[model samples]
Target: MKFRRKKSGYAVIEILLAAAVFVTIGTSIVYLLIDSGYSNLQGRDRVLAANFAQSGLEATRNIRDSGFDKLTIGNHGLALQNGSWAFSGESDIDQSGRFSRQIQISAISADRLLVTSNVNRIAGISRPLNITFSTYLNNWNKTTLLPPSWNTPQIVGIGSTGETTGNRNPFGIFVLGNYAYLVADQPSSTGSEFFIFDISNPQTPTLTGKVLTGKRVYSVFVSGNYAFLTTQAQGSTRPELVVVDISNPATPTIVSRTSFNGNNYAKDIVVVGNYAYITTLNSNSREFIIVNVTDPVHPVTTPVGSLELGSNVNALNINGNYAYLATANDSGEIRIINISNPAVPTLVKTYNNPGLADATEVLFSNDKLFLSTLTNSGTNPNFVILSLNPSDLSIAVIGQTQLAGNINGIALDEAGNQVFTATSLSSQEFVLLDITNQAAPVIKSSLNLIGAAVAINYNGSYAFMAVNDLIQQLFIIGQGQ
Candidate 1:
C-alpha cells in the first residue's frame, strides 16, 4: 500500500504559474480601491469650497435685511455649520477702485478634512429698510418731545444738547452750511417731521426748528436757502415732492408740490448747482428726473432719462457731473451716468457684484465710491468700497471691510479724519472708521445711536442721520464716548 502512493504529481512550473496569477489579481484590486477613494475625496473638497463661498454670501444678506449697520473697513469673519459640516468666511482688502481687490476666504470641513473658497464682492445697489418716519420738533426723546421729565445723561457730539426723540427713523438727512436737517417719516401716528439743528460745533449740538409734514418725508436735500423734500404718498392723489423754503430757518414753507402716478414711487433727491436730481421707479423701470429749479417756485422737469434694469434702483449718488446709481437684481449692478448734459445723458460704465448684493447707498469721496451691501451668503455682512475713474467711468476695487450687523448708510467726517457707518439691526451703533489713508480704512469708534438709521451725511466736522421709529428723530452724531 505504501509503494502505491507513488509520483503522479505536478511540475514546479505549474505551481509557479498559479502563484503569478494570484499576485496579479490582488495587485489590480488594491490599485482600483485606492484610486476610487482618492477621486471621491477630491470631489468632496471642491463641493466644500463652493458651499463655504455661498455661506459667506448668505450671512451678508441676512445681516443687511435684518437692519444691522456695523459694516466697516477691516477683516470680518463669519462661521456656519450644518450637521457634521461647517463653513467659515473672512474678508479683507487693500486700495480702492476698479483694480482694488476684496478677497474673501471661506473654509469648509467634513470630519478631519478642510476646504476653502475665495470670493470678490463687486459693486451694486443698496437701500435702507424699516425706515422711521414721524413728525416732532424737540431735541429730546419721547420724554423731551412732550412729556415725562427727561433725565438721561446729555449726549455729546454734533449740533445740539438734545435730539427730538430717543427713537431714530425718518430715513433722510441733509446738511447746509452749519445747519443739519433730519426728516422723520413717521411721528407719533401723525405724519413726518423735519428737525433742524445747528451743528456748528461737533461736540455740543443745538436744536433749531421742527416742521410737521402731513405725509412721510422719505427724502430731503438742502441747497442754498431751501430744503427740497419728497414724501412717500399713500396713493396717486398725494403730491410727492414738497418744496420747503428754509430761507428763514425757523419757518419752512411749502412753496410748490409735484405728484406722480400711483405706480411710481419717489425715493431720493439730490440738489446740485442749480438743478435737483430725483430718483423714481416702479415695477417697470428706474428713471432719473432732472428738474430745473433756478426759480424754486417754478420747478420744471427739464429732462427725464429712463434706465432698463434687471431689478429696481435702491439708491443714487451724484458727484460733479456724474451720477452713481446702485440697482438690485439677481446680480447687483452699478451704473454710472454722465450728467454733464442732463438732457442727453449717457451710460458710461457698469459693475456687477459677485453675489446677491442689495446696495443701500453709494457714496463718492476721495475718488472712491463706497457701497453698503447686504447678502444672505455668509454669517457676517459686508461693507464694500470701489475705486472710481470718473474720466472713463471705470470702477475698480479699492478697499472692502466686513461687520457684525447690517449696514444701511455711511458718513465721512473729512475733518475728523474718520468714517461712520449706520447699522439698522441688532446693536444700533454707529461703527466708526479711520480713513486717514483712504486705501486702508479701519475702525476707530463705535458710537451708539438710539434707533435704526436709514441715511447718514457728514460735513467734515459733524455727522447727521435719520432713523426709523414712531418719533423719527434727526441725530447730531459725534465721536463715540
Candidate 2:
C-alpha cells in the first residue's frame, strides 16, 4: 500500500517546459560572455597595434640619427617582425631639395594585414656624421651657427600699397626641378610677368627674375630644360601654349610657341617620358583635347581624344601609363585614361563623386591613387585614396580622410607616401598627410603659410608653394638635427 502511490514522475509536459526554460537562459548567458570576451580582445589588439606602430617610428629615427645613410626597402627593425607586425621603407624627394624617408607599418590580424602607421624622416645629407658614445644626451641648441646649407620658408601676401584690391592674384605655381616660379593672373598695371624666386635659401627666398608673357599664364609644366607655359589669351578665344627654355633658372627664353585656334582655354600640361600631355576645353569643340608636344617648337596635334564631359578640364596628373583628369566647374569626378598610346589615349574609367570638388588633383604613390578634393562637403576637405589596378586600369575607392579646409593644389613625395596640400577656402595653409596607409590617410601636421596658397609642388625634401601676389616660397619640413 505504501510506495504504490507510484510517484508518477512529474507530467511529461511539465518536465519538458522546465528543461526548455533552463536552455534559453543558459544560451543568453553564454552569448553575452562570448561577446564581451571578443570586445575586450579587439580593444587590446588595437592598443597593441598602436604601440607597435609608434615603436617602429622611433626605431626609424634612431637609425637615421645613427647615420645609416641610404636606408631603403628590406631595412626595418627586427622588433617589428618579432610581433605580428611588418613594415616597408621608401625614399622621397620634395621640391625643397631635401630627402625624406617614409616608413609604413602594418598589423597582422587573423583575417587582414591592417596598415596602422607611417613615419617620415628628413634625411640629412650623407656626410661623415660626428657621434660619440655617452651616457648623457648632447644639447643641440648649444650650437649658435645653423647649418648654412639648410633652407627655411617665408610666406608673402598680396601687396596693395597703391593698386586695386582684387586686380591680380597668384593663380598657379611651377617648380623647374628644384627652382620655384610663381605666376599671377593679369598682374596689376605690372606686365604679365612670371616672378621667379631663388629657393636655395628657403627662409629668405629672394626674387630672382621676372619674365613678361604674351598672355596671362594659367598653368605651367617643367621638363628637363624647359618650362611650358599655358596662357589665357584675350581677343582671341584660343590660349597660347608657350615653351620657355629654363636652362637658366633666372632668365627663361621662349623656345616654342603654339596657338590652338580650336581650344580656347588650356588648363594644365604634364610631361612624361618624352611627350607632353595637354588638357584644354576648346571653345568651339566643347571637349578635352590631348595634343602631342614631343616636338616642342612645332607642337603638332595628333589623334585628339575627347570624352563627353560637362565642364572644361581643370586638373590633369599622370603616372606611368595612365592619365588622371578632373573636369567640372565646381563639383565633378576624376576620369582615368589609358595613355599607353601617345597618339590615341583611350578612356578607361570614370568616378562620379558627390563631394563638392572644385580643383581636384591626383597623384600615384605606394600603388594607390590619391585624389585631393579642394572643397568637398562645404568647407571641410577630404583626401580620397583609390586602389588602382595598373594591369587592368581599374580603380576602386579604398581609403579617405576628411579635414578642416578646402584644398587647392596637392603634391607628394616620390613614393606618394607623404602628401602635401595647399588650401585657400579656410586659413590659407598647407597640410601634411601621411598616406602610407592608403585606406586610412591621416593629417599628421599643418603649416600656416599665412597666404592663400594656390598651388604646391614637392621634389622629395622641400615644398614649394605659390602663395598670394604671384610669390613662390619654399619650406623645409622634417625633423632637423
Candidate 3:
C-alpha cells in the first residue's frame, strides 16, 4: 500500500530539474530570434543607404547637365517640386523616413565643379551610418571649342629615317645644331639602332647616318660633339650609357659604353657640365646615377653618388644647382636634389599631390615646375604647374589644366609662352597649351595623329614628335602665330 502511494506522484527534485531545462532552451531561442531580426534590419538599412546615396549623385549630375548655375557651393537637398528637380536647403527626403541626403558642390576652376553626395541612415540608432561619393564635373556645354587656327599648329613635314626596317618605334629625340638624333627600337636582324637626321632644312629631314648599338635604345642626349644614349638591356647584358661621337652627322660611331654595378634599365638622361645624370631602374629599385663624362672616350661612374629615389623615376631635368626628378608611383612624387655639388648630391625637397598621380614628365621653366601625369580618376590628366622658389627650393601649386590623354613628354617654350605635350592615347597625340597666364592655361590647339606620340622636343618654331603609328613615325609641327 505504501509503494503504490509513492509512485503515484513524481519527486520534487525531478520537477525542479525539468523546469530548469525548459527555461534554458526557451531563453536561447528568444535571444537568437532577436539577433537575427537585428541583423536583417542592419542589412536593409545599408541597402537603403546605398540606394539613397546613388540617387543623390544622379540628382546632382542631372542638375549639372541642365545648367551649371543650378549648383551652388554648400549643402543642398534634391527634391521634386511641381514635377521638376529642385534643390532645397533642408536635407530630408519626404518618402524616405529613415534616410537623409545632402550634396556639396565646390568650384575647382571657373569651368570645373567638384560634386560630392552624402547619405545618412538614422533608424532610431545612436550612431548613424553614412555613405559618400564624389566626382569632378566639367561644364562641357559651356566649354569653348577653339578651331585649329586659334593655336596655329601646322604640319610642316613627315620623315621616317629609321622606318626602312619595318620598325617604326621612334622613342627619344634630340635636336642639336643642324642635326636631329633619334633613338629607335629595331628588329634583331636590322643591326642599326639609332638614326641621325639632317634638319638644316626644317621643312625636310633626311636620314644621314645610322649606328648599330646591339641594344634597344630608349633615350639620347647630345652634348658638344658627343651623343649620350641610354639603352635597354639585351639578354643577360645590363643596360649601359653609350657615348657616340657625332662630330660628323654623316657617320656617327660609338666611342665608349659605361655600365653600372647593378642591372640598370636607363629611362632618361640629362647632361650637366661634365657629368651625365641618368634616371634608371635597377632590379626593383629606382635611382639617378651620376657618371663622369668629361672624357667622352672613357666614362666613369661616380663613387656612390647616385641619388636613390625609392620609386620609379620616369623623367629628370636639371635646373641650375638643383635637379627635379619626377617619380611615378601610386602617389606621384617630385624629388628635388641639390646637385650644387654634382659629386655628392643631397635630397633637398620632395613634393607630392593627388593631382600628380603617375607623373610621367617634368619641365622647369620661368620659375615654375611643370609636371605631366597619366590619366587617373578624380584627377586632371593634364600637366600641373607649380611655382618654384630658386632661393630655398620651395614649391607651390599654381594651377592645373585638362589634357586629352596620357602625357609622356612635355616641351616648354618659355620665350613663346607655350607648352607642347606628347600623348600616347589615340586621337590625342599632340597638344599645345598656351601658358601666357601660368595661372590659367588654355588649350591652343590639338592634333589627332594616327600614331602614339611618345616624345616631343621644341626648337625655334618647330616641335619634333617621335610617333609610333603604322604609317608615319616622325612629325614636325610648326607653331605659328
For residue 361, what is the lDDT in candidate 1?
A: 74
Q: What would the per-residue lDDT of candidate 1 be over residues 236-316, giving only the tens digit for each residue?
A: 477667788888776777787766443456677888877777776545644556777787786763334444454556678
Question: How accurate locally, in lDDT, is each candidate?
Answer: 0.58, 0.58, 0.77
User: How well does candidate 2 score on lDDT at residue 282?
Assistant: 40
Q: Which candidate ranks first by TM-score, i.e. highest?
A: 3
lDDT (Cα, tens digit) per residue for candidate 2, span 1-481: 5565654566877888999999999999999998766654443333333334445455554443444332233333322345433333342222343323334323332222222233222333332211111011122223353452212222322221111222356667776544676666764445544666666655445666666675677788777777777777622344467787767766767777666565456678887765767676546553455666777766764424544455667788887778888766553467777777765677777766556665457776656777776566753446777787767766778878776666777887636566778876444387777867767778766655535677887766566776663122333333222
Model 1 vs. true fold: TM: 0.60
Q: Using lDDT as the measure, which candidate wins? A: 3
Using Cα atoms with residue i matched to residue i, what is each candidate's TM-score against the true structure? 0.60, 0.60, 0.66
Winner of 1 and 3 under lDDT: 3
Order candidates by lDDT, high to low: 3, 1, 2
**Worst-scoring 10-residue span by lDDT in model 3:** 159-168
Per-candidate clashes come to 69, 12, 0
lDDT of 2 at 356: 61
